[model samples]
Target: MENKNLVDDCLFCKIIRGEVPSYTVFENDDVKAFLDISQVNPGHTLMIPKKHITNLFDYTKEDVQRYLQYIPEIANAIKKAFPNVTGMNITTNNGKSANQVVMHSHIHFIPRFKGDGLKLMTRNNADQYDEAKYNEVADKIKAQF
Candidate 1:
């Protein structure tokens, strides 16, 4: 059996280990999603890679393929369950530095509406520098690729 978490005592790992229970939404060979009991919004859901990586950057190619495959279906299921929902936000936090409470590779499908708990995060644009600066940065990134 898998060790489940990168380190033992991980709550999400316990869920995978069946040492604890979660209100699961979907489970397949490589992924699992469950209802967020502490729902940010109704039907709030969480999905995770079955392997014991801590975040997205650690996912192997096969792990990534399997992880991506379930996202659309998971999103569709949540949307279907709450037809009144206006929009959806899929978010993942990477590290403790990023405020990721659980040290496991997981994504969240947070439902959004006109006014709700999920809308707590505000969006703001970063200041755009001159066009020359933008082009220089973009060119450097393109070169790296």
Candidate 2:
């Protein structure tokens, strides 16, 4: 049975159910890893929970831990399968504000090399390291924890 969040319309859910085509690399009861169609790099892949959840904020502690615990094994498999993967980047975009296109929460496993010409970051001119502000923000987040 599907939860209200796991609609047929959700792309990841369709892939999980084999209703849509995907280059599936790994799957367990709780998660699935597949080659990303967009292929940000030659071996870019995605790991997602089999159950649909909108974003990181929607994950329960158990859900998050269970899915994340499999990442290292999945990442190692990707590294072994892809050539010249000197490094990897595990990224998750959380919300619309973070440019999350897919509603389902997923981690991007981007294989990196010495000169792949891929860059995950740019200088944020407005970003500043303010000690006082850092402490204040840390305290607020700590409260939630």
Strongest candidate by lDDT: 2
Question: Per-residue CA lDDT of candidate 2, range 10-42, in tens?
Answer: 999988878899998888888989999999988
> Candidate 2: deviation at residue 19, Å?
1.4
Most accurate candidate by TM-score: 2
- Clashes found in each candidate (C-alpha, N, C closer than 3 A): 0, 0
CA RMSD per model (angstroms): 2.4, 2.3
Q: Which ten residues in a row have the lowest lDDT in candidate 2?
A: 120-129
TM-score of each: 0.84, 0.87
Can you give the lDDT of residue 120 in candidate 2? 75
lDDT (Cα atoms) of all candidates against the true structure? 0.82, 0.87
RMSD value for candidate 1: 2.4
Cα-based lDDT at residue 97, candidate 2: 88
Query: Native-vs-model 2 lDDT?
Result: 0.87
RMSD of 2: 2.3
TM-score of 2: 0.87
